[model samples]
Each structure stands twice: as structure tokens, then as C-alpha cells.
Target: MTGRAATRRPGLARVGATLARAWRAVSWYVKEVVGENDYEHYVAHLRRHHPEARPVSRREFERAKLDRMASDPGARCC
Candidate 1:
């Protein structure tokens, strides 16, 4: 490879390592907060905290969630 290409190798390696660390942190947080159960309890928790979370069909919830995700980059779908 050329000199420039060789120079970029370490930068790419550092970026890859940073991304791996971030992914691991997120994975650990999810496991600790939500455990391995389905999302029903979390939904219920939300309803308890904010009584406005009335019952809605699963299909509608999923559709709205997907739409929000498509429009908002900051939204987390999981």
C-alpha cells in the first residue's frame, strides 16, 4: 500500500474498537434494565407512570413505532 493508506490504518482500527465498546455498553444496559422478558412489562410500567398509556392493539403500536423510527434518528426501536 501507499504511505497515505498505511497512515489511515491505525485510525480505522481505533474507530472499530470504539464502536465495539459502545455496542457492548448498550448490550449490558439493555440486559440489566429489561432482562430477557418480552416487552409487555415495560409497556405496563410506562402505563403506570403515565396513565395515558391506554390499551392499543399490537399492530398499531408496532406501526407507529416503526414510523417514528423511520423519521427520527434518535429514536431507539428496541
Candidate 2:
């Protein structure tokens, strides 16, 4: 391998490690804040806070959420 490529290896590895740590942190935070089977509660909280927001069917909401996550990795659940 070229010396330049060797030098870049550690930086790439560090970035991968940082992303892994961030993913774990986010997973833990989600579990703590909204464990499994809390979808209804979450939606209700959203409704309470934004009374003007229109309601969405469960299937539509889930599909929209999945699309948002795919399009914006940093998007948060509302």
C-alpha cells in the first residue's frame, strides 16, 4: 500500500468508530425516552402540543416516518 493510503486509514477508522458510538448513544436515548409499545403515547403527546396538527392514520404515519428517516438520517420523531 502507498504511504498516503496508510496515513488515511487511521482517520477513516476513527470516523467509523465515532459513528458507531453515536449510533449506540442514540439507541440508548431512544430506549430510555420511548421504550417499545409507546407509539400511541408519543402520537398523543404530539397532538396535545400541536392541537392544530391534523391526525394521520397509523399506516400513513408509519410510512411517512420511514420515508423521513430514509431521506434525513438526522430527523427526529415528532
Candidate 3:
């Protein structure tokens, strides 16, 4: 427990914490940008708007979305 060693530990911990926050932010941003969170949003919407109904599985939701998009490719990004 020298002065330099103690200071380095705190500084390194701060940097590590900062990096963790930054990584989480980036991960969330990428998920939002790429619609990775769509199923979660869909489930929430269903719960809000149709509480009596059960939400579809993620795979089914994605498959139906893909089918819709395939029928109208122009509606999506190039």
C-alpha cells in the first residue's frame, strides 16, 4: 500500500467503470439502430394494447415481419 499503487488502483477502477458504461451505451444504441429491440417493443405494445392476448414468439414475429418486408422491399432501406 504505497501511495502510487493505491492511486493507480482507484484510477484503473474508474477507467474500467467508464468503459463498462460506454460499452453498454454502445450496445443499446446498436440494438436500437438495428431494430434488435423490436420484439421487446412488440411484446410491450401487445401487453399495453391487448392485455388479453398473448404475444407471439420472437421467431414467429421475425418471420412474419420478414414475410411482410419481402412483399414490399421498397418500404425498407436499400
Candidate 4:
């Protein structure tokens, strides 16, 4: 290949890698901000630390979390 073509390939590869890393970071940030990944982490934790315990479904977990937050006055701001 020519010099220009070879340089373009490396530049393209670097751009692709940078985009992939940025996408992953943004994806993770969105999930955490929206609490979407909480259950996934909870399930993983249960599997690793409490093999005999059953994991809560996402709906139930969300419901319980809401109830707990509501009951705890300290969890909210006036």
C-alpha cells in the first residue's frame, strides 16, 4: 500500500477504538443514572455471595426500593 493509505488505516483504527470506548462510557453512565443496571448488579451479587438466595424480579425490586425510600424521611429532601 502507499504511504498515505497506510497512515489512513491507522488513523481510522484509532478513531474506531476511541468511538467504541466513548460509547461504552456513555452507555454505562446512562444505565447508572436511570438505575437500569441496578438489578443486573444485584443479581450478580446474589449469585456470587448468596447462591442459595433467590434474586428479586426487577418490578418487585423497584417497588420495594420505592417503598423503602418513601418510608425513610432521611432519604429525601424538604
Of candidates 2 and 1, the better by lDDT: 2
Candidate 1 lDDT tens digits, 1-78: 599999999999999999999999998789767643234655787788978867666666667766876888774554
lDDT of 3 by residue, 17-78 (tens): 99999999999999999889999999999999999999999999999988988999996788
Stretches > 4 Å off in candidate 2: 36-78
Please list the C-alpha lDDT of all candidates, in the order they appear. Answer: 0.74, 0.78, 0.94, 0.91
Q: What value of lDDT does candidate 2 attain over all alpha carbons?
A: 0.78
Return model 4's CA RMSD, one decimal: 2.3
Badly placed stretches (over 4 Å) of model 3 are none
The candidate that wins on TM-score is 3
Compose the digit string of candidate 4's lDDT tens values, residues 1-78: 698898899889999999999999999999999788988999999999999999988999999988887888794576
Instruction: Quickly count the clashes in candidate 1.
Output: 0
lDDT winner among the candidates? 3
Please report, as a residue range, the 10-residue window in candidate 3 with the lowest summed lDDT: 69-78
**Clashing residue pairs in candidate 2 (N, C-alpha, C atoms within 3 angstroms):** none
Query: What TM-score against the true fold does each predicted structure earn?
Result: 0.44, 0.44, 0.86, 0.75
Q: For candidate 3, what's the RMSD?
A: 1.6
User: Each candidate: RMSD to true structure?
Assistant: 12.3, 13.4, 1.6, 2.3
